[model samples]
Target: MMYKHFRHGDLLKQWAEQAEARIAPRIREIEKRVEFHQWRLLEAYRQTGVSEQHLSSSTGYGYDDMGREALEEIVARVFGAEAALLRPHITSGTHAIAACLFGVLRPGEELLYITGPPYDTLTQVIGEEQDGTGSLADYGIGYQAVDLTPEGKVDWPAVQKAIRPQTRCIAIQRSRGYSERASFSVEAIGEMVEKVRRLCPDAIVFVDNCYGEFVEDQEPSHVGADLIAGSLIKNPGGGLAKSGGYIVGRKKWVDRAASRLIAPGILAEGGATYGYLRDFYQGFFLAPHVVGEALKGALFASAVLEAAGFETTPRYDEPRTDLIQLIRLQDPKRLIAFCQGIQAASPVDARFLPEPSPMPGYEDPVIMAAGTFVQGASIELSADGPLRPPYLAYLQGGLTAAHVKIGVLTALDRMLTHSPSESAKLER
Candidate 1:
């Protein structure tokens, strides 16, 4: 019933077989990277002397909790940061980043972005596009940006010229958020940091490091990032963290972020770990292998999608720095159909149809097909994108490459088959 409906089902099978062989070497290389990161994580755990006692939770102010203290130390050491803030109180990656931004910046200061507009969700946080919700701009923090060059590289000259006396922070988004561009490498971020220091020696260099963790041997902090933030449910969570975020950087910045996360006087003292410490610790340990699995899945997805006559960013053979895999459907119906097929493959909510609708912190009506245990965890196999032009579907995360292969094949089958009635549903 499946292949009988798909005109190109045979082609999809042939392409997948070929891609598996072609990508074998790449998969081996990713496996090596995973092993290296695992060693690094083990060393951090050893350095911090994490013990079973460190897995217990503390309630009623959560002060003097040895596990909490050691967890923070391990995270900071692993990230090459002077200090770190790891708290379940910090709800989302966006919340963690906002805490750092508000903590270090004053009302009169300016925030400059060397990397065009940030992710869509952050636009609302920056108050660049008004959402009627209070944001950094509402508090008088000014925001400005310098778009990347046509080739997707940093516009260094513009960045240098844009630096002002009021410029208090320079925001660098490491991943290509909702855009078809190359994500910045850790080495590239270091170069950007050096240039910024040359122009404004005192301005803080902040990196939105979502989706970039464990994908490299070194982090933004290792390359001179003064402040960096990310969500635990992403790469670092290893698909296990139920909720939380992290901020790692200089002691002063982390301290300020702590103040913002809790109350000014409490400052990292009152937040409770609620017995999630063990999962968080275990997640960090497993993150390297899990992230490697996601990357291999993306590479394989790229190969199969391209062979199916659709365009893909960072073709399977291209270098990757993040988990996102963009596919260009170029039509709303096809986009919806692709998402529906992806949703169908989900282990949870497979029977539910995903519809395009407005979500908080985004401008467009976005369509998403995610059935992750962590609720929007991108580290699991998921796909989503805005229902706007280019009609791109940003597919990311797969706990295993075999699952990703199945999802891709399923989507291709649905795209090529499906009754006119089902097509009408997509058209709706």
Candidate 2:
């Protein structure tokens, strides 16, 4: 109490005394909470170890064969799907969404993506201007995306207005992968889905459920999504899975969606059977722990960067409802440097990209972000190219508190080295 009144060295004794008085009792509960999850995760890890054994020895069936089956079970059980299909053949979360779109929405029919300003890939996949023969337009699919506003949210009126009679599906990309501002909560999305259903019950509601799986035990599937999509090696797999794609919900939609997998039959590329039985299992096992750790990373990144006089989105430790954290640097060069700073801390990275340069195929020059997810974009990392103006950079992902702290430190250190006083000035 005296320490509260005066500022001096003996204050340390009073501070320690008060801290013990305040925290001693809480320690047991905190330890129990932490240990309970830790042990559960350890058990999950053990399960993963066993699964790895089976995964390696299992042959003739090959990687795809085992992975798809495991994933199907994981999706059904973990995500609460009526029927689930896992395809190791599909590339990423976006690929899974496209498959669902192509499978459910017929060519010449209208399809609406309610999630505005989704990943850049969505534009390419749905637009006719780029990606040559790959656009949804090439296949005769009429696609429209309703972008969010300056408040970083969907234009609900616009979403309602965009619906057409031919609309087969309304896609809601729940991924905050590229966005630093905000994302839809499962309940919020559920509200939107319910409203959309009121408008058109037949139209499927598809959510890009990446960076979203297992962050909370109950996912959108629980809230009644027609279909939810994500990648295996991301949050679901807990940094343990090698590869796979997920599409779950609405049995009819899933059944129809499978048709697009491996060309409709004969399991062309390892035959579209819920085949990969193991990776899916491992993914579920690691998801809880990995997600918790990833949240910790996000919080820590927010803490450090915000302390460094940099602006951070999601506000860090206050209350994280999601996995990724965005540290916004309005300067484009600072964004690149931030990305490079994070890479310096990654165990797997040898080099990091921090510049917006042209690539072989991309229409715009994007400053590439590398997150060492086994299949890419797990509870991984990201750095987005700015849309315009101040050109903010987004830094996100840390599967563990330690990793998040180190990554943030490395970024801050790198940033310090490039300050105006410090020489090695970044290209503005």
Candidate topping TM-score: 1
Off by over 4 Å in 2: 1-71, 129-132, 266-279, 317-319, 351-354, 359-363, 369-377, 381-388, 421-428
For model 2, the run of ten residues with the poorest summed lDDT = 2-11
What does candidate 2's lDDT look like per residue over 33-53, in tens digits?
445545655553454344554
Q: Compared with the true structure, what per-residue lDDT tens digits does model 1 show for residues 357-380?
A: 999878889999997778988899
Q: State TM-scores per candidate.
A: 0.94, 0.79
Please list the C-alpha lDDT of all candidates, in the order they appear: 0.87, 0.64
Range of the 10 consecutive residues with the lowest summed lDDT in candidate 1: 419-428
